[model samples]
Target: MSGEFDRVARLRAIFAGAHRGVILGIGDDAAILAGDVLATGAVLSTDAAIEDVHFRRAWIGQGVTWRDVAYRAAAAALSDLAAMGAEPRAMLTSWAFPRDVGDDVVDEIARGFRDAADVYGAPVIGGNLARAREIGLTTTVIGAAPARAPRRDGAQAGDVLWATGALGEAALGLAALEAGIAREPDAAAFVSRFVRPPSRIDAGRAAAQSAHAMIDVSDGLLQDLGHLCDASGVGARLDALAPTREADALARRLGVDARALLESGGDDYELLITAAPGVDLSRIAHPIGEITREPGIVGATTARTGFDHFG
Candidate 1:
């Protein structure tokens, strides 16, 4: 008798028979699962990181440590939970390492993950290890939210927009690391941003209570905010509150366009939120900009505008 088709068909068969609780099974950037008993409508999301694509060992050179890398990964995954206005509860981490790296490096990396998880009350549950030509980490995080989960599509016309914390420092830090410039103290702050990025879980939870919509600034702020506008069928207008001190100074130092950097730089991980015109934006500490009815447009007061991935 002829066996089944190839491996792909077998895998599809297995997937087709899987449980239906998988609200969003595979085939997207993240997988969303049904919540536990307490959180009947909770959602879980996960993402992975590969060596050359997500990061490079050469970027750290000799100063940064492996532990820092693990912390950064955990923080990044936690940020995804925050973007959805969910409270992170647990995480599963898997790693693949090359034989050349010592066990000590791996231990340090695990320690980093533990420390970061502890900071946010999200414990590491379990993971797997394997040999590979390079290092990789995949973190699966579970989070809890109310019945109606916040989504990228909740934004409305005339909703004011805002961002938490500063911008472009992380990108400038990456630039400095790549250029091997170790003199500026700001560079250290930037590198620290790269090593231990902060997730706006608190802000996300608060925004969910009132804000119309929200998203994390994983890509450039403008690009991600544009995502929210596109998903919600709206546009945006920047008010007086959207400049980063670091962007100006970095512009002077690198002779690069600060406006362009602010628009296109990635990895900030801050929350970009939108709400009605009358909402008290001051309630949230990091107020950045606002939303308007001019569809598909994001207008900034300064020369710096927005980012387009393919542009």
Candidate 2:
């Protein structure tokens, strides 16, 4: 496959058959009601975290614990609800643990998920447990949708693009962990963000007031922006873009480009919004750009696709 998006598109093209019960399928942050639990018109999404893929087990002794890993996985899944302008309701999380691990470790993992889920008042509902070679987590988040779901396909030209919080916060933490800096005292902030990724539920609910479209930046700012543009059949301009302060400082310390991190690094998990003209958008996030008639990013350095498991 050329990339993750290309692979997904190929699969969808081959399986063009439709399911009458699906309100939205395979293309959004979460699928709307019709085929999933909470089928009373609520939005639902599933996300996965696999050992040695999304994270490594070696980090356990190096400042990253199994509890943190479980929490991150749950937070990542819940972020999908935030993207759809939906209110958190409940989650079903499936976990696979090897036989060698102690039962106490499993309890700790469940507690971790519980801690994070408690933040949005989304309790763990039900899930499966199985034997496996390594630990893996898959969480499905269900939420009540607003009257008109904020879709990625609804953005139009001339609409303004806004983003919740700064970009690359979580990526900076990932970089620290990769560079063996997680042990450093100054790395706490970045490491915390990486381990305890935030779900922008409130921000998304606020944006729903005027947002024409919305998405969560789990895949990276530029990459997810491209997804939004492609869905809306439009383009965007980054002329008004400004790098996150943390991104700039971290990039300088690491001898990398802040803009590059902001553009292509994944796992930020912030909201990306597109609003119509004359509508007062939420002040919770910063304005990044405006929609355009053409495709691709403009007004800065070129950016490639963000992380893809199979790319």
What lDDT tens digits, residue by residue, belong to model 2 across residues 35-101?
A: 4435446788999999888898777867788889888999999898888888887677777777777
Number of the top candidate by TM-score? Answer: 2
TM-score of 2: 0.84
Query: What is the per-residue lDDT of model 1 for residues 128-193, given as tens digits with 9 covering 90 to 100?
Result: 567789999998887777554568898887777777777666777667666676346756777777
**Residue 37 in candidate 1 has what lDDT?**
26
Cα-based TM-score, every candidate: 0.81, 0.84
Model 1 pairs in collision: 161-289, 161-290
